[model samples]
Target: MKGVVISMIVVLAMIQFMVKPGQAISCGQVDASLAPCVPYLTGGGNPAPACCDGVKNIKGMAATTADRRAACNCVKDAANRYSNLKDDAAQALPAKCGVQMNIPISKSTNCDVIN
Candidate 1:
């Protein structure tokens, strides 16, 4: 009985460590997923299939509020890195790709307000 109880406690502790809270996405992942979209965003043209795929991937990865906010911040940071990034193109990206994003991909967007 003592051994069984101890094993159960160990399992519970392991489960706690396995389930991390509020860190579903990282900036590196966001950057990788959205990198392909940069060219289209900078220069007006039909977004490539890879760009659209990246957009969709970003939407899918942002499952939780934290993830969404992180993605938003990362996108804003990435956009800032490119001075030529077009606002019109960024605004049109989600609709153009047929992907709905909770957080708009813009440098000016307030990530903290994304819920």
Candidate 2:
């Protein structure tokens, strides 16, 4: 019985791991702050229309003209460096999204500036 219980526990743990956890969006569902692009940020979620709309409303980011250009190039470079469309497309994500990639949010606005 002891062995059986241990096996069952392990099975349960494996099942939980296999299950899709939840939305990958860190800022919550469709919030303006995250631009409804939470999924895109995780490279697994889909960008909500509201998120796209919010992207347009964001104000100035902390970046210089040169830094913006460099950030843009970095986005492209990251895209090429990563595998799969999700990872590559994430290169264009905003500051919030960039944070998920371990890149600083300050670098976020540059991708748009470069494009």
Candidate 3:
């Protein structure tokens, strides 16, 4: 019984790290040429026009190349810059929702792609 209880607790703890918020924050208001794009994955209000534009633009950039690695890199870069992703959410975002955020890495690269 003791071992079973301990195992359950460990599993639940691991599960917590797997959870992520619905959305991310955006980078519209900021300078575009520098950072270019930001994510509004935090899910509070509708992302600003610029935010949406940036994402579209990044997506376009990624599509242009067959590698598409840039798209994932862009998303990861954006998440690190715009969103306050920390701890589990940050980790999970890169791992589970990397595509959603446009990043391909399964771990936080701590990239400063944005200026």
**Winner by TM-score:** 1
Best by lDDT: 1
TM-score of each: 0.78, 0.30, 0.35
Over the stretch 1-115, how does candidate 1's per-residue lDDT look in tens digits?
9788557545644543454555577666666666667779999797888788878877877888888988899889989998999999999999999987787988799999999
Residue runs of model 1 more than 4 Å from their true location after superposition: 1-23
Report the number of clashing residue pairs per model.
0, 3, 10
- Whole-model lDDT per candidate: 0.79, 0.40, 0.38
lDDT of 1 at 81: 91
Count of clashing pairs, candidate 1: 0
Candidate 3, TM-score vs. the true structure? 0.35
Deviating ranges (above 4 Å) for candidate 2: 1-43, 46-62, 87-92, 95-115
lDDT of 2 by residue, 5-76 (tens): 557545644543453433222211112233244456556555666554444322222134543344344434
- Please state the error at residue 52 of candidate 1 in Å: 0.7
Task: Give stretches of model 3 more than 4 Å off.
Answer: 1-43, 64-67, 81-83, 86-115
